[model samples]
Target: MSTPLLSLRGLLKRFGETVALDRLDLDVPSGEFLALLGGSGSGKSTLLRMVAGFEAPDAGQVLFDGRDLAGVPPHARPLNMMFQSYALFPHLTVSGNVAYGLRREGVPRAERDRRVAGALAMVGLEGFDRRLPHRLSGGQRQRVALARALVKRPRLLLLDEPLGALDAGLRERTGFELRALQRETGAAFIMVTHDQGEALALADRVAVLEQGRLVQLGPPRAVYERPATRFVASFLGGANVLEGQPDGAGGLDCPTLGGTLRPAGPLPPATTACALRPERIALRPGASGTNTAAGIIEEVAFRGDDSLLLVRMPGGAVLRVGHAEEDGAPPPRGSTVQLAWEAAAVVPLLG
Candidate 1:
């Protein structure tokens, strides 16, 4: 196989007593959209900064297209980083802002003009060259920042919470726009975000970090459907983690639910817990099938397309369930309902 466009080998960073990155390893192929996802102090931003040359690791290597990045400054590196704030200069026009990097590099006037124009057009800002940053909307400002970064034609692009500044509706629309822009440019896009929805929607693959360690990395659906650990299962959302011991009868001896549950497939010998997504559960009037349980609805929340229900299991465990509203309304709070799920929907998780 060909070498990855970018590679991180045993990367480590520390700040006195705190470890920012703990020997993390990653690779990015050409034109791939990868998101670094984690909560605060999980090293997502730190890792991105190290790659962009804003920070250096104490150990290991950062390789860009098979070349070492040590001793390279941010401007000298073959990449551009767009900050969370969009980092646009209020005094500069859109064209001027896009051309700033080129001017710093001493590019000739005519060549800079051509590249700036092309970059603006690429980001759907063709006719807004003369507009200043203050005059542009949030989305427009984001586009200007992107155009500025892309005008240099970098081999890699780094985005730090690119859509965090936009409202919900605009963020959703811009997420697709950013994905499309990355595809069009064919540059490997590495983005750092704390928003789970943004990572799931925008990234081709997601790297989930936790407390300075790499927790899980895979395709969005794979990571969500088959979480590697309890942290991942809970952190990525929509999962009901149940702690139990093997019943030695092709199922789990879950004390919390006061029963046994057979997982979809054979589990690892050491497996002690499992995750079941709320949407995978089917609610009905009676519990007569395998993996069935009786629970009282503790809370009901309507979420437009679905209703999120918190159910109190017979053994006192609160299991969250997301039931689709297409068929009918969810049972009212305090109603006893039977929850059933297929074994296949259960994912065995590590401690």
Candidate 2:
């Protein structure tokens, strides 16, 4: 296989006694979109800063292509970073902001202008060249930041919470646009985001970090569907984690559900827990079958596109079941219903 476009090997960072990154290692292939996902203090931003040459590691290496970036300055590196704040100069016009980097690098006026125009057009900002940052919408400012980063034509781009500043509606729209832009530019992107939905929606692969350690790394679907650990299953999509004892016959005796669940797939050795997604469950009026449990509806939450039903089982465990609005009105609260699911829907957790 060809070498990865970027590689972090045994990276370690610390501030005072708190460890920021604990010998974490990762790789980003050429033109791949990778998201670094974690909550606050997960070392995601620190890792990004290390790659951009803004921070030095106490141990290990940050390799771009194949060369180490130990002593290189941020601007001297061949990659650019788009900050979460957009960080456009309030005084500079859109074109001016995009051309600042080129001017600093001493590119000729004619070449700089051509590159600036191309970058602007690439981000769909053709006629807004003269508009100041204050005059543009939040999304427009984000595009200007992206264009500025792209103007240099770097092989890799680092995005630090690229959509954190946008409203919910705008963030969703811009995410797709950003993905399309990444494809068009064919540049490897490593984005640091705390938003799980954004990571799953935008990244080709996700690296989940916890307390400065790399917890799990995989494609979004694989990570969401078959999480490697209990933390990953609970963190990514908030899967219902049921703790139980292994029955030795490829089944689990779960006290929470008051039953034994037999998964279609073979269980990992010493498995003590399993994850079931809320959407994987079906609620029936009256049902009695395998992999089924009766519960009373504790609450019904009406989301815009769908509803979430909280069911209290006989064993006192509350399970969330996602119900689509298109299926007509959901059953009222206080009603006893049977929650059924296929054996294949249960995913065994490592811890």
Candidate 3:
């Protein structure tokens, strides 16, 4: 691959007695949209701030274009950050706010005006240049902030919960817009978001963090479909993790699910858990496979496109299942059904 436009090597950060980050390393290729995904206090914001020069790592290096960024002031970095607040100047009009960065950089007046206009146009805010931040809608304000950040033509753009301020509908809509804008501009973007759907939908690659440590990093599909650990599978949603130990006959003896799960391939002797996505499981009328178990639908939640089923297995384990709406009305609550999944769908996870 081409040289990474940005690299964080062995990065470490701490606050008092808490370790905010622990020897984390990541590489961002040019124009790749990477999302740092984690729950609150997972060091995602700390990592983003470190890259933006707002915070310093206790150890290791933050490199951009192969140059160390140690001691680089926030304003001196060749990157721009858009915060959750949008941070557009309420006193300045859209164009003025966008032009502020260029003016700070001491660009010529004509160049600043041209770039401001182009940036506003890029974000679909061409006609709102004279509107103040308070006069614009939340989405518009967000666009203005984006315009300001892009106006400087930064090599890397950092977004911290960029869509967090918008309503659910708008947040989902803008997520696609942001992804499109990133692709159109070809500027590498590193977004920090707690929303799993946002990260999975917007990012080309996702870095999953847990307790200040890098837990998993990969393409969205890979990370979601083949999570490396129980935390990842649970955090990303729709995973039923069961305590299991290798049965020695190429199957995992899962007492909770009351079955022996035979994954597609051989598992390590130490493997003690198996994770299966809810959507990967199918509810059938009768048991037919080694990976099948009988369960009663204890609860059902209709989620528009799909219905979520809480299946209580005979062993008293509640396994969440995502049954497609098209499969007909979900089995009524209290109805006993067979839950089956292919052996290949079972992912053996090590503790």
Give the deviation of candidate 2 from the true structure as CA RMSD.
Answer: 1.3
* Model 2: per-residue Cα lDDT over 38-115, one tens digit each: 878999999999999999999999998888999999989999999989999999999999999999999999999999
Clash count per candidate: 1, 0, 0
- TM-score per prediction, in order, is 0.98, 0.97, 0.97
Q: What is the C-alpha lDDT profile of model 1 across 130-160, one tens digit per residue?
A: 9999999999999999999999998899999
Q: What is the lDDT of residue 184 in candidate 2?
A: 94
lDDT of each: 0.91, 0.91, 0.90
> Candidate 3 — number of clashing residue pairs?
0
By lDDT, rank the candidates, best first.
2, 1, 3
- Superposed by TM-score, candidate 2 places the C-alpha of residue 252 at a distance from the truth, in angstroms, of 1.4
lDDT comparing candidate 2 with the true structure: 0.91
Q: Give the TM-score of candidate 2.
A: 0.97
lDDT of 1: 0.91
